[model samples]
Target: MTSKTGAHLRLLGVSLLALSIPMLSGVAHAEDASPGASTSDEASAQAKSGIAEGSDILVTATRANELAPVTASLQATQPQSIISRSFIEDSLPATADFNQIALISPSVSNYGAANGVGLSESKAQIRGFQDGEYNVTYDGVPFGDTNDPTHHSNTFFPSNTVETLIVDRGPGNASQLGQATFGGNINMFSRATREDASAEIKGSYGSYNTWLLRGVLQSGAIRQLGGAEVVLSAQHIGSDGARTYSPFKSNNVFGKIMIPIGPDAKLTILGTYNENSFNQPDKDGATLSQIAQYGKYFSLNNDPNSQTYWGYNHTHKTTDFEIVKFEANLSPFATFDNRAYTYSYDNETLSGSDVTLYATASAADIAKANMVTLTPGGAKTVGVPGYTKTNKYRVYGDIAKTRVDFGFGAITAGAWLEWSDTYRQQRDVDLLTGNPNYVEKAVKDPVTGIATPANIKFDQNSNTNHTEVFAELELRPIAGLKITPGFKHVNFNRRIDADYNQTTRYPQKLSNTYTVNLPFATVNYEVNPALSVYGQFARGFLAPPLSYLYVADPSFSTIKPERSTNYQAGAVYHGHNLSIDADVYKIDFSNKFAQDLTAPASQGVVYYNQGAVQYKGIEGQVTYAFTQAIAVFANASRNYAKTRNPGEARTQVANAPEYTAAGGILYKQGPIRFSLIDKYIGRQWFAEGEPDAYKSNGYNTAILSARYEIGPVRIGLEVNNLFNAKPVTNISPGKTTLFDQYYYQTGRAFTGDVTLTF
Candidate 1:
């Protein structure tokens, strides 16, 4: 997509959203408050005073020991738009019961689906960084899969089971320890029983043959008995699928228990199990014949204006996923999290050599049998190709923290140790013979032992142990001014035992490497009660890119970890009826992890740190209420990123949507509340050099939702991808999984839902 196209789309989206503003302007404010809602008490009075106060960002993030502070970073909680519990109840995903909305922050972006996967395997990215290069935490502890289930970390608790979510952009805090590159950390707080029990149920059905059913039952309080809360939820979804000739299904269960030790202490144990199954759909793109006949991605069999299954991209597969987690929380001070995941999948990834070929051939052979055919030489190995894969991954760790408060200021500190391991096995077989993809070409040369199967078996079982010691202190010598400084020392060692069983040779045990001392700092000044200014200067680290980790070879050694120096200044202000926040930031990135293209082809691509980049931008959001029944909000962001030197052109850096703007209005009256939102993502130059070829650019997507209530039962309708936006792709060097053509986004659709609270 070009900048012009992007700008045009943004204008169109903005106009549409603005048109609906009046639709929710008139509403009868429902004076009857929901249970647990403020009850005209001290808490209610404070909550009603500021939009930021109701965020629960501080409590969920830093686990603040006290009440709400007048000047807090709205960006701090999520630093982006929030996916509130109310939002989840409206449009649920496949693993709704055990899922929390992700990449919902300005710094985060979500693009994949959990169709054939589970909550833990859902893919995401943060701050222009791949999801794979992230550090996740369940109540502030290490959370990320080494091998088992790869990048699935969403299963610690269910969406409804969560109390709040906090996203820290850029490298994580001194407390977070793991393999994090450009992405920040996500802090998920499990529901606790400081209040009463609540039960809710929701169901929805919509376009593209979609349906969703979800329910949550939660145990509230044992406050007198040291505070105990139990929660359980289940979700089921069935969709005819997004594109042609595709259908999908999934089921998930999430449950957990929270036991408190004292007013200042707590213990938590949680587990989630998912039984998910689905068929991978084909890719979506324009075929050659279609391109010539009616332009790219066109159909002739249908009406000139209609769409055809032929233009849709398709990927086929069957996969089963599962995950379990345990976490211990010690009140407003410390937390420990451990998780285990196992998954197995089988599928035939059929990449039709070309759409034009498929189209021309089909057109030439309808009488023979209206079927698509491929030449033996047409199909190439795709992914772990003849897919038979198994993985068992685990992470066990804990942190002990203690904090002290004095009349002048407060001090906080903590340390942790983590052990992670994974076992992965993959083998591709010939769909017909049920043997390795290739059989020995019975030749006299066969004496050399059945040549290493054409389609080989590459398996690896490894263990990683990471020991980290870290600490942070917040010194507030003055009532509204504060300073924070922190540092972390981490040592990681990994051992991999790999085997090419086909050759029947001794298994190979590979050597390992490490990364050392990282420090960061930030300072803030609260000029007044309703306003504050703060600036943060810090350092961040990222392991050599994914290229190095997945395509491992001795030639690709000494992969230095990437380093970054980032700085930001922002302000937070809240008036009686409105709140606003804005920040400007820049990141000087170095030691980029890129492939060794300079090396001979015989050297094999070994990923290592080599390039440098600069990422700088500004982001902000505003919320205003005209009356208790009417509210309006807008969020905007802009970023500039490029290779440090003009010499470099393209690199699949991460999710950097150069510009984003969203606006919406929420109106509620007697049982009826309607919200209309418009979102715009500016044009992004995805790849380098081939600016005109082999790359994907950015586009704008939007959403709108409205709800009507009758007693305790509420019904709603949601319209997503209002304009049927296209999926943006990035330019990849060669044969990279991330293509210049990425996956197509979901088109415009409607979802009708019903919800009940008891």
Candidate 2:
């Protein structure tokens, strides 16, 4: 995808979103509220202001401490967890990513990256489900690659942009819309605009030459704009990395504006843009011989002119996002909420690979020969440098929901519509001349105004349209018992208008549409104000990835959608000084997707449909305050995953840990604060049939942190991986042994940050 095409797509997406706003507003006005209303920052503010002064609302404040974690978990119909802003600040580095934040929750594991905070190198698993098997959303809007419904963490929202993280361990109610709702959902809420005018400056420096600087400015409500408030934030980060040749740099700009539409309504708009470039580090684990020769952080090549040179292998990515939201109180018993969003991602990854013509010799041997002397006739025969991929896409979506109170309980109804258009291609280039080598001819791109290689390895244009309508009712038949039932109708349409490969010189077009009806039910018994128990059953489905259509094989279109049935039971206890939450869940998933990672990158992705997989897990979390100045928190989860395919060599899913656990102690006295956090991850498998060599030993990591505050300035320091444990988090399988390919978790690192507020 070229820059000119990206620009045109962005403009078109913006125009479409802008034109749809009035239509959405008209729809919102026609309906009132229902049950389980979607909460917005505006709604939260309204609730705070509506509290009667000196009333019972103030009395409940005395019990707020007792709720703790239970306060958030007990409210959900299925297993769930919440991480607060304060906990995030206390437990993680300022630059941590969502994968890191997710580790605080049970049943979640984040394989740390080579460069700290480089999301591209990170992968997360929840309850034995891989990254693309679950749903992740931003403020209720789902964001991901149109081809796979999987996210590229490096191209989206960063940790600093979020204020809260909510992890639901089961398929949510009918209101939730996503392709991978079966494994569950992670919802990230953006930081709210401050109600008071203020400015904050933050800077951090960490081990491995990592540094970050950020600034935020907020303007309080302005009388001229009907009590409007705005916030602007900018940040820059760079790191030399914990692993050799793994360097990262990024810049982000974000803004938000909020306006009170009327006494009972509000409008908010947000926009963010990010640009990043980073060196691609070696992921293949070092062999025993290589480890002996170069240590753990070993990459394949070092020659300056080699394709695998640290200087030659890199990727560039850019993202732009914007959203408009409106919320209004239609009546004392009704509310309406709606949101529209537009976003685009453009990424180009350049990588080096073995020059096929000279593949007879090992890459190392070729490097050695070329380094010693070059052929007299021409430039040395170095490895090929090429764009591994160029993926550019624009997404637009809108959701409108209404909640209303009923005499028995409440009812909620909503609809969601989304569309995406993508342009993707890949081609090889000359290593010495920095021009395309495999191009059989040259042709001018109509949009880019540049001569493009006619011999594209892969080229395609894809478009996807998704629509859903959901309705749910909350029924309270007794004082302590509540039952909810919901249903959602979902439809997906994917069209691959053009798919081309230089080998065939033919364009193939494919289109597919899938429709399904999902039903969900939950039963909750309060038992008492301090205790609650809930059980839920739900069904969900995932459409086949759009990229499958681009495969050269026409049979690829026959792939079926993945589907799942989920069941969950949970209990929560909220006491005066303690809170506990526990849950057990099971999912029966069919038509699972599997990939052949052993294949080379230039071959594109090879996917197969694994018959079925069953997953079951148990998770528990507890928090206790021994005194006003001291507290302890702990969480753990155990998971079991197995495939039903009898012919398959391995029954257990690969890359998922058997268990995960975390514990921490917190202390605060006056202006001083402290925390000691510990985490443990159980063994993770890399191959089927429980191959002993292709598994990680799993390791322990700890963090110590302290902070002090005086006036408007705050200072903090943290030491992560305090023990400097160099544990393998992933393994690459080899024909003879493990470590043929792999990456290790980052080792011990230190970071210190200071913040000034005015």
Candidate 3:
């Protein structure tokens, strides 16, 4: 397989070089015709004049092999949503994760609370289905997470390493990555083709005790002969986060290289590595009173001294990953590409309680258990020490792509294959030597510290393989009007190998699974040189998450893959000073799976195929460039989504705020630039409850920033969450209700840094 794949790759490269010969000779003739600036610095000047990612569909846009988000490249399919790095920097979230960008899109909303997890549960609602179903890719390569779909993903390479982001709001042109069941797709790529060598660094501080340091490097330094171009980036982030027990550390390393094959062609190579160790304080479920007294959070495993609230859980999790990508530009207009990647995760958790150090007293001397009920970690707490679970996971994937310019139009096609394996081993201790739950033996011995008399083990192993194929046609039947149509097919084969009873209790084998998608069409009409209108019909689907398999514990097995259909229309208006974009969409879903807590805990929160749910909304975004020194950008959107279960009531998905509003302005004059951002996320539901109406806390977050650039040096300062306002998260309903859930927020924090470029 390796030799075959390699041989095909080399052949593709040779063919591309042969085709570029004619284009190269023509370019040389024109090179002397124009005596323009020839250095890297000169190219930057030319780019700023009018080279938007737009009409340049054949240039930088195709380098990453993704369908560019413009009327030109997308004419054969659907309206493509593109967010350039310039735009990303202007609306970056105060939080560390850049994936939060999903919240900035017109029809997407972030709906979730910070559970025991450190960050807000990013239960995103895109179009008419949940976010988990979307196909996420980087530089034309798929990068979806294998964790439960309901869980937030940590697979990004960070903002500094990005060039542009493409959001296909619905099922996109089906080239290989057609697995999206509902939410559709998100794609990203790095900056390439630069002739200059430069680097930059920046730092910031926020409302909480937050700090971040970032860096960027770009160049084609070795391009004089048998040349090469490269981009590299590294960053470190540490923060005293706002939530009850959230504190985190994140680090990343990324690089991309381009090697020339001929005057008009080159082979592009790219790689990325990110590792983060996040600390959790186990204060997720603490009560207001207990939170205020015990520092609001503490380690549930080690600091057994915490008596106020024994619910503390704390520890660190590490995510280590790397990816390598290669592309052969057989010619200026036609190319072939391939990529291989590996992602791994390691988690170590420790649980601590306030009642572990207690000592039993004589029957006569045991006056009484204090009226306040001695807290878990108090002087009279239980002695059962604790238990721990450690897990290791690894995932691998590879893909191949080819694009050919059939004289009439361009044909883009590709396929992706991937697999994941996991191993988990847990040990349960007898915190109290015998039965800690026994009333008489509950207390611990201060001397011996209540030794663990026995330890039980739990082990599990599992894996899955995914395969896909997709294609699209960018056709131009005539001038000014373009049409695109695409199709995709995906197959998944998975199984579980587990030992629940120390024996082969859970057998393992691959089960065949498959789905095919068709994103029929997208039409674009260029009314004039400055304005355009587009419409599309698309489909997407999301496979059942690995978590769903947990329920198959040999009993109460259930579920089906979820799916969604979408219809969208939008207009883009670009004038001399004002730019406005408007989009409206309606999405429908089938077999949506969600958490239902009303059912008992022993059974866990199971998923029920809540039939037929729908989401319809409108988004209006506007930007005004008043002058070379000042500009303003604004966006507002509303989504109306509801469960389809009849008489059973219409409920909104968790973390889905109905109205999302944003407005920001940037002022730049010479070496000084300033910016202000404000965003509003309307209230939404958080749990399965009793009331017919939903429950949520409304919130608004704001930020202030400034930067100074002199020659090759740029310095910046930013104050995030300037209002120190905590977005209302979680909901506590029913006073005096025994089952009422508690609510809280991640507090505001602050951070600062300097960078240089040459």
Candidate 4:
């Protein structure tokens, strides 16, 4: 049988197995005792005490009973997982990148490139979906690049400031807003303001000469400031990464202020600033032969005189954010929330390609041949020494929501409005002097009196406007049944104006608008206080990305939105000693945008709507508390994502691993805590149509962490990739040559941290 046929058979078998899960409900029921309270009053009381994890932690009876089931949120009708603050601090990898912290959950994959956390490149994917296909938000506010839906991992908020990370394994309710909400969503909440005054300082040193220092100060509730509380934090990190020539550094500052307005109202303002720089990293993976020659973790040239020298390939980025939010309980049964926010991103980069151009000629001879001035580096490069790129953008938005409850049900309504203005350009410059050869037409620096060129490379000014309004109704007709239905209307507008290549072939100035309505319905049935079954049906939409709308063609307007029908069913159980959750999901996607490389080379690559695709998966997590101080947890996911386009040989998706598993043992005794973990990723196809030589090998990694506390002092140590495994983490899918295909991860590394609280 053919490989494609074998894959299809396996997928069918998995689906059949998943559909048979409901029959096992009797087995779970046999293990439980009599049920407990099932009233809203009980739930309200439980919420006040926070969620509990059974025997995972020893607590007083009041504390244990008071804690609610963490998985049973009113708005989360599908599967959801939460990584708590304690877990993040005590069990995660040393780097503590949000992307890494999320790996313990099911149906997620990440490529944390060879750089320090928050100082280089990284991406996270959900199910078989890529980076831009998922929604990520901080403090319930969504932010991303205006030109594209993806986010910059190194620019915005860092992991230290986060309190909780919640990954919702489905497109959430009507309140969630983003271009890629069709896939799933990630919700990050910042650390809460402290009621008591305290200060914390931490220092750490790890492998690859990595160093980190951070400090935080909390100004307890201030009576003079109307019971206000404030928090201030500063952090610095520097590292020589696992890869050759990849050095990184970053610095950040954050502040938050909270003021109590009245018995039922509060106002908060938060701000953050981050600046970082790192050597330019290649996206294409190095091949086996290249690794044999340069050793693993190889990067570009390191010779100072070469144009591709480590120092010559670098990027500098800065981000600034500020937000003000207000919350008020309008009445006993109603509440209102509103947020206003603004943020900006600035990036500048210098990089080079074409290694032979510099290696084959002398500086003076090459300069004479090209008629350009001789530059400082070794041989004059046949290519430009510095092809610089700059991107700067500013965003402003406001979101408001209101919730009201009647005797039998609740109503939620929300609206969002956002505006983005951006400036992007690329040009050649002198690498050594950092002087650009071209500037905006009719523009010049008054002091320098340098003439600006009217014709250069590419430059554009773009603006985007987004508006959304949504409403959801929650009805609780019976004591153990709840139903939620919601609808959202979205309108997006894009405007682009400027110059392209300055050639006669292309012109600039274009605008497009899209409007769509999405609907969602979910039902949750509580068989008992500790067990619940849920199902949902959602309609999702994704407009053509900015590239297809503006950058591809100046006047093309036929591109349409991508639509999907998503279905999910799951069961959750939270008991005195066991917490288990499972879910089965399937999505039918139409008008899926797939890259078309068959067009003439002169026209360049573009996107085409490939007819339809189907993605199905089964993911689940189980955690059992052995005792008050010990627990074990495991999670696994299996996915089958294939395109249904006619006559397509490669049905599989690229960069998507079919299976992933994570599990570990956790121990907490008195003032000390420790964990040993393992993570595995299955083999993946690099391209849709490819032979065995182009495929990627699977990899396994192990992590260990331990922490101890005494009074106001805490010490922690972490060992990542404990087996010292050198494995490829990424590969270029469609590249014909094997020379650029494999990117390896860092070997075993150690980090220790000491923190003092006062």
Model 4, which residues run further than 4 Å from truth? Answer: 1-75, 116-119, 281-290, 354-384, 430-455, 501-507, 550-557, 594-607, 733-735, 738-741
- Cα lDDT for residue 736, candidate 1: 39
Instruction: Say what the RMSD of model 2 is.
Output: 9.3
Candidate 3 lDDT, tens digit per residue, 177-264? 5346356665655554355667767666554456667777766457364556677878776755544445566677777665655443
Q: How does each model score on lDDT?
A: 0.47, 0.67, 0.50, 0.65
List model 4 lDDT by residue over 577-618, tens digit each: 776779899998788776666765555455677777788999
Full candidate order by lDDT, most accurate first: 2, 4, 3, 1
lDDT of 2 at 337: 72
* Per-candidate TM-score against the hidden true structure: 0.74, 0.85, 0.75, 0.84
- Candidate 2, number of clashes: 12
- How many angstroms is residue 313 displaced in model 3 relative to the true structure, after the best TM-score fit? 4.1
Model 2 agreement with the true structure over 1-758: per-residue lDDT tens digits: 11221121111011111111221000111122221221223423333222110000000111323223222333346776666556566658877777777777888887746456553457788888888888888766888888888876656777667666667777777777677878877776676665568899999998989899999887876778866878888988898766667678889898888777767777779998988888763233445555555667655456666555676677799999898987776877676778899999998876664322122345675554332112222343543444467889999999887777665777778898999999987765655556654533444433445544443676878889999988878787987576778888999999886646333334667678988899988887767666678888999789887756645453433466788999999887766567677989989999866665665555555566767888998999887778766778788888888887757644668877888888877776677778888889888787776778777768878888899998898899999888898877776665555226556767789999998999
> Is 3 or 4 the stronger prediction by TM-score?
4
* Native-to-model Cα distance after best TM-score fit, residue 210 in candidate 2, in Å: 0.9
Model 4 worst lDDT window (10 residues): 20-29
Candidate 1 segments whose C-alpha is farther than 4 A from its true place = 1-83, 90-104, 107-110, 113-125, 147-162, 191-194, 222-227, 262-264, 281-385, 439-451, 501-506, 545-556, 600-607, 649-655, 694-698, 726-742
**lDDT tens per residue, model 1, 626-722:** 7656767776677666666446664434445556666666665567666666656555544453254543456655666678888889888877766
Question: Best-fitting candidate, measured by lDDT?
Answer: 2
